[model samples]
Target: MNILSQVTRIKNAIAEVLTGKDELVELTMIAIVNKGHLLLEDVPGTGKTVLAKSLARLIEGDFKRIQFTPDILPADITGIQFFHPKHQEFEMRPGPVMTNILLADEINRATPRAQSSLLEVMEERQVTIDGETLKLPSPFLVIATQNPIESHGTFPLPEAQLDRFFMKLPSGYPDFHQEKEMLHMYRTKNPQDTLKPVFSLEDILVMQQEVQETRVSDEVENYLLSVVQATRSHEFIENGISPRGTLAFMRAAQGAAYIQGRAFVKPDDVQFVAPYVLAHRLVLTMEGTMRKTKEQVLKEILESINVPVESEAGR
Candidate 1:
């Protein structure tokens, strides 16, 4: 199947369980296609876990869920070297992170050390244990969930760790009709069991490669940079999108273009995917926080930023 067809099939498969959050689902797909980790922050009972599972199932990837808690240790996540009497050497056991699709359930509940263990794997796709580096499975994607409503027992993720994630998505509660449909659909049995893979791991990898080849015009490139530059200069934001954030935005826009069956990105593609790609990387000033929601601030920034009509016309 073509890249667009693959994306559509994947979306339809996940939508079987996720229901009406098409935009969020699409963003999740884009992140995966772009080979970026995702952070799903929302209240409980919003199907965050289910969404992760559904994505795993639909992609036919090896899925592992790590329940992050205060008691969890870094060794528990990255595994440890254990002495083996029979082999006369220490054996390294792989952790849940070894899998292709990793669901870090309630990631905030884990202590800083446990959370820090993920940094290397998330960025480099490899884990260093006992000074030995082990590569993770191909097409590795982490879909982490955090409850935004509770802060009691949870260790807040540091800004640096937060920046590691490509996009921080809020999987909000479903609408009235969507919830009703969900109730009806799950009245007798769970719907997730019925979900099947629409594409294989190899197919996903192919699409990721295809996305890289998607042409991003100089105009769109300049527009993307302009938006990122604006965020840095904005009075409301204490710190804005980083260089890494700019790269993430570009990848996400390419993913969006691939999803739309386009080989080249347009200005609209960047705007459509900007908020999810940029919002989490932003740290608003206290005044900005008091005055507006991050989403509101992002929207205003997008509105205020001018789009380049042509690439060389200005030059």
Candidate 2:
């Protein structure tokens, strides 16, 4: 019931291991509580994988990781139905997708066929194996990490595939002070080794249910819709946020409010989560790509829109 305290404990727990990345941890938590998938575009050592592992421990949930490569097949990720000679029958085996938290590491490395395999489970939270459908664990989340700098042997995710993610974050490098702190933190011991769960899977489920209950007003709804419309007509954008994205934008605002321990959504909440939810979904025009990044163009759009009165937001 106390969303702030619960979120605070979880963030502090993750901060112990992920030094100087407080904001990243917060966004990651928001995505998790919303039961949305995460797409992390970061360089090799920005603690993307650690973030997933830390979340798994925080909720006392199952954590499974798959290192995606070109040779990875759909069966490798979703499991296969194999025949047992001794038993004289066929048995179904579930893949890593069955876990509570799944880390699809270097997701861009896998071929389109292999990548497409996750489409069903991610959206439906269930896997079909030889005509038998198996449900994934409760509070399931996919934290898919990809290397942004490496193009060698990498297959870029198509627009449809990218839309599956709830948000895309670049886990930027730590600052000087944070980097120095990290060296000492790891010098003593791996913080994760002693890390403990801040909340149970049941708690997470409760938060998910409760986050949606956070109120979104007509004013805030209109403001959000305006942003979605901006992307569609914006000169620099080739493709704007989809209808699914529009829903995600609103949901993310609710999640942001829930994390802040607020009972109602505000224009501030909508503004705060805009970049994380919308930037990656925007397809930039050639001119846009050459002139500005997605975040920059999105910022322009945000500046152009008028924010609603704060007092009226709670009503």
Candidate 3:
């Protein structure tokens, strides 16, 4: 099937399990097509773990869940080499990070050392063992979920670690109608039990390539940079988005365009993806943090910035 069809199928399949979260599903798909990882922050029982598993099932990829605890070690995630008595040789065993879809449940619960171990694998897609690097499987995606309400046993994710995630999302509760439908659907069995694969790993790789080829005009590029620049100068923010954040915003826009079945990106594409791509990367001022929400600050930034009008000359 084509890229657009594959995207739609993936979205529909995920929606089957997660009702009334089309926007979140679409952004998750965008992160996949852009070859980026996702960080989901929400309360418990919001289907955060289920969402990650459903996406893994939809693509028919190898899925593994790592429960992050205070006592979890780096070797637990990256595996270890052990000596064999008879052969006088060491054997290497791969950890859950070797899988295609990794569900890092309660990622914040782990120590900084254990959490930092994921940095190389997430960014470089390879694990270093005994000075030798082992390559990970193709289409490697990490969907990490953290509990937003509980900070008792959790260690907050540092800025360096947070930069690895392409977008940070929140899986909120469903509406009354959707909740009613969910109750009706779950009466017999969980929806996840019946969830099936919608696409293959090869199809996703193809979509990723297509997303890279999606047209992004100079005007849109300038507008994206301007928005990032605005964040730095804004009094409400102490630190704005970095250069890496700018690239992420552009790539997300391209992904959004591709999901819309368009080969070229539009200004609306950038607008739709700006908040998710840039919000987490921002460092709010003391006053803003005390009195305003990130969503409110993001809205103010969007409203204050001018959206550049593209000229017909480029078209």
lDDT per residue (tens digit) for residues 14-57 in model 1 = 66777787888789888988999999998888988888888888
Question: What does candidate 3's lDDT look like per residue over 34-147, in tens digits?
Answer: 989999999889988888889888998999999999999998998778788899999898789999899998999999999999867898899988877799999999999999
**Best model per TM-score:** 2
Score residue 228 of candidate 3 by CA lDDT. 88
Indicate which candidate wins on lDDT.
2
Question: What TM-score goes with each of the models?
Answer: 0.94, 0.98, 0.95
Off by over 4 Å in 2: none
* Global Cα RMSD, each model: 2.3, 1.0, 1.7
Residue pairs in collision within model 3: none
**Which residue window of length 10 is worst by lDDT in model 3?**
306-315
Whole-model lDDT, model 1:
0.86
Q: Which has the higher TM-score value, candidate number 2 or candidate number 3?
A: 2
* Residue-level lDDT tens digits of model 2 in 154-180: 999998789889999889999999888
